[model samples]
Target: MADSPEDTIAAIATPPGFGGVGVVRISGPNTAALARAILGRLPAPRHATYAPFLGEQGETLDDGIALFFPGPRSYTGEDTLELQGHGGPVVLDLLLSRCLALGCRAARPGEFTERAFLNGRLDLAQAEAVADLIEAGSAQAARSARRALEGALSHEVNALLDALTGLRVSVEAALDFPDEDVDILREAQVQARLADLSGRIDRLIRGAAQGALLREGLRLVIAGRPNAGKSSLLNRLVRREAAIVTHIPGTTRDVLRETVSLDGLPLHLVDTAGLRESDDPVEQEGIRRAWAEIEAADAVLLVVDDALGEGEEEAAIRARLPGHLPVICVHNKIDLTGRVPGKQGGVLYLSAQDGQGVDSLREHLKAQAGFSGGEGLFLARRRHLDALTRTAGHVATARDALAVGAGPELVAEDLRLAQETLGEITGRFSSDDLLGRIFSTFCIGK
Candidate 1:
């Protein structure tokens, strides 16, 4: 179904500032009327017509290309118009003002895409991929976003939903026909199917987890005693002198952060002050902040100077780190120790000063992040992961119930819950508030 044409909306679709060309997009029932008024004639549907844009007083505002898409075929599944003109801000503003003056209201942020979703042109996940594609930081991320927009994730989710639906029907049928001698719930074939479904859900969860990692990169915090080459390691990872390198201990009295793409994976690296008891108030504050970063980090790179080896100080730092967080023990300054650069016993040995063994650290970080080079991947948000996790939990519970010969009602309820939870990913089951919150984060015109 297409959106109603009565309440038309308009926006400058192109980004702000000067460019080779700018575009003003309009959609609604009034699109044709607006086109005739501005372009002097309704453009041929889906054709690019060169024309002059006219103001209220019959004056030429700008000369450019006008494109029209009729209802049920446009992006919003409504009558749509796009005016391509010069990229100057003033020119675009004049064009937009002319649109508003012609009774088209300015579009809300992401209203265009929202309308498309509402009109059944795209599902919720694909709509989100529109924004992810625009903000993608790497080629891999962009490709993943494109795949998601093309319905890769939605297809898998719907397949799971279909399987769940079939299982639910069979369970309910068994409940309805209690006189049957052979109990479907206790059948070996049914149990096998349930196990297979659980396996499929687990596989989807792993893929979604990887996609989530690609969407939101890892936060890695570097921590150790002063002058352990923590700052040098940060500089080496980012390929820049992002942090000050000094011989003096406690030279870095604050946290320094740098974002770098490590093999198509976004790596947020934070360098913190040397962790130790300090008499100075400023250094004490720095140490406090450093611990705070470690607490919130996805992983920590615990740097240990090769000269110092794994001493009491390193042990103490290890004891303080969060037990659940992944900690990569980095043995730095291996050049001086004449040790080869590589990973040994889950610890990375390298020289940050000489750029030795950094590649090993990169691979280790990627492995820790569960990033698989973005192949067969799709962009996913934290909410998507949450939904997938919840769905998997419900499916597992259903399988367990089936194994225990639980009542059909219990199994059916679990299957139903799992289906609905999975549906949230593509918005087959969603609330208005959730939709509002998701679209609000998108930029205007998209």
Candidate 2:
């Protein structure tokens, strides 16, 4: 494959596994040339043609559908070609080799998506949402990613930028006419607008926080005294005999983790060694690792035996957990204890064996993560949060500068800085290196 910047990029467009249909995608100025070389004729632009895909030696590799999308309106804004063929690894490899032989280079990870963002076919945030949508772990997460891909998040960012641009233009006009001696006090009006914008950005940041939570999900550690049915609860939650549940104390000597979704919120649930003094070295090491997990978790599930009561046992365990780590106290074996399975404050009573009260606990967990079980939620990344934080900080600085009557020129600098920070979220102010890092994480042929 040539290293020329204008060389066409090609890749298998489906998952690396057997399927009913597999697709090879190509995009660049050389798309039509490759299509002619491989398919024996140029594919009709924006149309599908059934044909026998061929190699350079005119060997029939697989008969498939060829589709073409001319530059400007297509994804990546470049001449594009797609070959849908039988989903076999051998067939895909041969077809890919043929494309390479015809002067089409293999695409890098996320190259297609990167090109799309670079060509203005999609904003940076929306481009990221495409990958998020593919990797979504829950229906809620997928819906959120779809909303973001549809421009819900980018629309808000663009609206904020437009307002900031207007304010910047006004300040620049005042700067151009220094002889007018524009009273800095009059800039209060602009400062007020910046403050309002900052408030809105705050709201968006909070919403994005919830979106990120739904995307990254919660890491929950189950820790409590020995014989609290922690293992049983884990098995029940995961709906399998994943752990060895026994009556003997200190039975679980290691940590067990499983990824589970509760009411559409993904969570990494960890069943750790019960937290208590132990004579065995293995149990001690497990306790140490359990604490480490508890510290790192986004939330903790303190499992307590309802039949045994939760007074001093629960207190000792709570004292060991890191402050600020959210905990949900579970009174397991509620059926045996005759306590109704329900949630009160931060405590949830449930019989792990019978599967009672699991629904209420799942609902509570989702509510804690800001999931309302609706389609309005949209996926967001940590990068967006950082940009919003920076933007909010700049907007605040500009407001302070105006309130003190420092100068319209100074306030204007803050406003411009805020705009740049906000622009980075959607690549309006992004550098090539940042763009490279973001797109390189995506699967090929995005």
Model 1, 119-201: lDDT tens per residue?
99999999999888887877887899999999988999989899999989988878888754667534565678778887887
Scored by lDDT, model 2 comes in at: 0.82
Worst 10 residues of 1 by lDDT: 241-250
Cα lDDT tens digits for candidate 2, 1-446: 33554878999989898999999999999998888888889977878799999876788999999999998889988989999999988899889888888878999988888888878999999998998888877777788999999998999999999999998897777777764446454475676777789889998998888788777777788887788888877777666422222111123433466666665667677776645679999878776776676687888888888878778968977887788988888888888888888887668999888989977877777776666555577799889989999999998988887778676788789988999999998999999889878877788888
Question: Number of backbone collisions per candidate, in order?
Answer: 1, 2
Error of 2 at 226 (Å): 4.9
TM-score of each: 0.86, 0.86
Clashing pairs in 2: 144-378, 144-379
